[model samples]
Target: MSTRTSETTVTFGHPFRLAAIGDAQPAGTYRVVVDEEEILGLSFLAYRRTATTLETPAIAVRGGPHAFHRVDPADLEAALEADGKAPRSV
Candidate 1:
């Protein structure tokens, strides 16, 4: 099996909470990392998402080690939608 990773940033206009994170997070841009595995034995190449994570403390925060929390894609999308930001496809 083969895998690949992708990273992107998401901005929240208001504080939000993710079930996985267990706390309200401040409004800011956060780094989102996604891991996908390549599907084999197919006529067309494709990938399936294996995991998704959000960087805690926002990316702008400094002076501390950032923690990545595994988050559900739907939960993140709902959070973003509630924040008035369209969730970008990860």
Candidate 2:
């Protein structure tokens, strides 16, 4: 079994809340990490998401240890949609 990780940045125009991360997070750019595992016994190469996480304290914040919170992809999408800052292609 093989796994890979991808990281992307998303920005929120307004404060957003995620059930996984209690409390409202201030509006700012955040780093999101997604881990995927390669599917075995497949003729074609493919991967399935194993986990998703959001880095806390925003990227602009300093002087604090960043915490990674496991978050649902759907919830993150919804929050971004609500903030009108949908994830754009990198």
Q: In model 2, where do residues sit more than 4 Å from their true spots?
A: 87-90
Per-residue lDDT for 1-90 in model 1, tens only? 999999999999889999998889999999999999999999999999999999999988988878889999989999999999866685
- What is the C-alpha lDDT profile of model 2 across 1-90, one tens digit per residue? 999999999998899999999899999999999999999999999999989999999999998888999999988988988898756532
Pairs with steric clashes in candidate 1: none
Instruction: State the weakest 10-residue window (summed lDDT) of model 2.
Output: 81-90
Provide the lowest-lDDT 10-residue window in model 1: 81-90
Q: How many residue pairs clash in each candidate?
A: 0, 0
* C-alpha root-mean-square deviation, each candidate: 0.9, 1.7
On TM-score, the candidate that comes out on top is 1
Best model number under lDDT: 1
> In model 2, how large is the Cα lDDT of residue 52?
92
TM-score of each: 0.95, 0.93
